[model samples]
Target: MDVLLERKSVRNYTNEDVKQEDLEYILRAAMSAPTARNTRCYSFLVIKNKETHKKIAQIHRAAQMILEAPLAILVVGDEDKAYEKYLPQDCAAATQNILLAATAKGYGSVWCGIYSNEERAKAIEKLFDLPTNIKAFSIVVIGKSTDNRPPKNGWDPEKTKYEKWK
Candidate 1:
């Protein structure tokens, strides 16, 4: 619960690179996320190259953090491997898992959305030379944080609804 509350989007990062073992652990946590019909139809595209990160940052205006982060990961979804209806949900779950795992390991991370925007998606596909069947869902930038922020709890009682809307 503490980890969940502390999991905030970190945009600024230090020069230190993420550890290989930590990256592997984050990927493992992502794969552990629950998928519809047990169809883990997500592929992780790890971007460690500075040029690739720069290109990605250019592709997504809101993802400038990619350029500064030591590493970025694209959580891609395959329609042929998983049901199209469940692709977004499955990918989002995997993304959240990755963020939480990174936070638990004392790493900073950010989730940059890319699935809903056609231009962004195409750019990613072309940049990574991904197949037509695979689509980039989200980008997770990971690195050592340069800033420290306290946890945020945005629980709103007004937004909560019981069994039925009042």
Candidate 2:
């Protein structure tokens, strides 16, 4: 619970590399997220090579932190098993899982959206050779952090609804 509140989007990182076990655990957390209709169509590609990360960052300007983080994760939706109505929901849920898990493990990470804009998204599809069906949803950059920023519980209690009418 403490981890949840204290988890922040960390952009700067340390020299140490994130452990393979930790990465695997993070993936496990990502997969544990609920998917609409249980389609589980989300796919993830973890990039750790400094050179490749740099190239990816170059392609996607919004991902400047990719060059600094020791680990980067691309979460995509697999069109093969995709449900048109819920693909975006599934991918977004998975991304959130990865972010929270990264924080829980004492690693700081940030979620960068790529598929929201056509031009930027097309760059990812071309670079990864994604199928026409697969949709890139977001990027999660992971590493040891230089600062500790906490997560915010952003909600409005006044927005609550009643059992009957407004």
- Structural similarity to truth (TM-score) of each candidate: 0.95, 0.90
Candidate with best lDDT? 1
Shift of residue 42 alpha carbon in model 2, Å: 0.8
Model 1 pairs whose backbones collide: none
Q: Candidate 2: RMSD over Cα atoms?
A: 1.8
Worst-scoring 10-residue span by lDDT in model 2? 147-156
Model 2, 1-166: lDDT tens digits are 6766777778788867889888999999999989877889998999888888877888888788878788999999977787766877899999999999988888889899886777877888888899898888899999999875546766687778789556
Over 4 Å off in model 1, which ranges?
none
Could you report the Cα RMSD, in angstroms, for every candidate shown? 1.2, 1.8
Top-TM-score structure, candidate number: 1
